[model samples]
Target chain A: MSGATSRATTARDAHRTAHVVGRVLGVGVSLGVLVIVVGLVLMLLRHPGYTTGQVPLHALIGRHARFPVGIEGLVRALRHGSAAGVVLLGVVVILASPIVGAIVAAGGFLAARDLRIGVIALVVVLILLVATVAL
Target chain B: MPITPLLFILVLVLVAAVAGLLGSLVGLGGGVIVVPVLTLVFHVDIRLAVGASLVTVIATSATGASRLLRRDLVHLRLALFLAVATTLGAITGALVSRHVPTRVLFVLFAAVLGYSAVAMLRRRPEAAPRAGHSDAVANALGLNASAPVGEGGQVVHFEVRRSILGLVAMYGAGVVSALLGIGSGALNVPTMDVLMGVPLKVASATSSFMIGLTAAASAAIYLSRGQIDPLIAAPIAIGVLGGATLGARLLTSVNAVVVQRLFIVVLAVVAIEMLQKGFA
Candidate 1:
């Protein structure tokens, strides 16, 4: 009876964790995609000739290419109200979603007192943060 | 064809949607398709292509894993445990990528993929969960999980075996991903399903969940380097998120045999692609 109870409890905790993680993922993606679409529409509206020019794949990737990069650049562009800045914000959100999800999972596991898995989750989160910042 | 920016974006979104759907189905991150299409068809630089592909991988992973988690297909504990190895390996691979010869790495990865394809083909699918099958390491780590296999919410409990081996394989997969600028989901699924005795469905879903973390590690570097062009990445992300969401929904209803067959085909194609890159 104790075994069965413990198993049931574990399953319940897993279910709750899954539920919370799923919501986080869904919301993150939806919000990011919406922002990107809005930015794209704004870009097209602002530059009516954007559709008229040929795709500048080569120019866009050239050494002289100028675009926002990193957090500082992203903030500057947003301040300038540039469409690309809005889109970059969306991309940033999309990129951050999984990391956020991992953090939430770690908290959930720790709260549930699954010390082994919780510690593992925390370790993973640390690796990810270090990789993101350092590498 | 006059490839205007609007037309290019439309085509990319369409192609990325297909890549996202297939990738989510097999947990491959869709980088293979996205990279090729961007570089070959759109004439985008390889660096930019890789950046866009990383975004696609993250998008597909997030959307697909989210749905899979809701269905209890993802083994969250197992994924978290293995991610430590993979993330560290990815960082190491990135650091060593410039020193290694690309051709040799490509050929070696192709061979590994070929062997994986053959091994997966020969292995029989698990019909039902094994009763009383337990592993000390997995039990201690709480890696064993249950999945809803069929109609009427029937759940099948599965055990994880040889978790240490799985972690090592994931580390290798991460290295390959960073070196080749691919998701290495081919390696991940096989490691979990073939080597670690994880059910194929669970393996694929968990792999999907895991790949995002691996891709994010590289994506941050790419973003800082200005490799990710907003115009290119935005559409790919949007399209992949939509397609992956659909693919995750389909996976729950699809037959395991069908998914396996499709994965084998994907592995074979990836191997051929790597071989071409290797010998070119």
Candidate 2:
């Protein structure tokens, strides 16, 4: 192969490799978040205030498959619903945290030599996460 | 006997695993598959099921966006524009959806499916790079001129008008996504590729990239309304993200034509089922 062609091939190969490394790192982050979520759910279950409902998650979902009564009905149920929403939000953030972390980590990893891209990706993700939490 | 919580979790995991794998493989990201299964098999409330499905859409987008962005398949500027339009459309559509009968939404979905099927049949199997896109057009559209597709590869140029149309379609996609809880891939792919002249692969990847933003737009509304169940969304999102990663990996070896064809057929069948439910 010609030198230029060979160099181009190597560059593409490197790009692909870096891309895969970043994604694999991301998956690792997602798994870590999943673990943390499970732990928190377990802890929540052990607490005195919370108890497992009579129906499994699947059955509850199945039985309630109709459209919600409306905003007014939900408003009436707000006291209980809001409480659930707060806990639910926590579970979502915890479960989803690792995926975001991994994605940011992968960007940083790929940009290891390049400070700008690495810093920008990581900083942006950190900001988004913090913002999501604040909201 | 009632299924245990553990068993329900297992079922969710199984669905996610399958959806993730199939979604990545066929480019639908399995939200379409998961929505029906959750509703039909699990008997989850359509509203909550749709809500959960939207979360899966986010997972699919997140998993696909990072890699696709690096590959230059995701058109960031275009996506940003579409996101704005689609978000506006989503708010309008969601409000309208709430007041309209559920059957109307079902009828609209059937029409969308019919439109998408015809659009799919008309799409080119092999994406052809469009001719006549100049450097100025590329710069104007804010498309990345730095990385042109491979050496001597024609710089993929796009028309602003068609992209706007694609965005309009995406607005419709946002509404459909909010209503049905499926990733708007069925709508997005055709709009971008057939309508806007993006390559098939880029169209699919870009659609995936767009889903997160679109879902985020509506998820807030659902969250406020107390429609989001953390216990449900948590497991579903985790499963989808993991499954999509595996699916993207599997896409490397799969026969995409066959898979996509089968997917179109499955979509057709589902659309018919939905029509029955609507008209009946």
- Pick the TM-score winner: 1
The global C-alpha lDDT for each of the candidates, from Candidate 1 onward, is 0.75, 0.56
Candidate 2 TM-score restricted to chain A: 0.31
Candidate 2 per-residue lDDT, tens place, B40-126, comes to 576565666666766667656766676676665655444544655555555555455567776776676666666666666665555
What does the lDDT come to for candidate 2? 0.56
Best by DockQ: 1
For all predicted structures, in order, the TM-scores are: 0.84, 0.70
Poorest 10 consecutive residues of model 1 chain A by lDDT? Answer: A1-10
Tell how far residue A59 is off in model 2, in angstroms: 7.7
Q: Tell me the lDDT of model 2 at B241.
A: 70
TM-score of chain A of each: 0.83, 0.31
- lDDT at position B173, candidate 1: 88
Ten residues in a row with the worst lDDT in model 1 chain B?
Answer: B125-134
| Tens-digit per-residue lDDT, B35-109, candidate 1 | 656754665765677677777777777877888888778888888888988887777776675566756766765
True contacts kept of 2: 0.09
lDDT for position A47 in model 1: 68
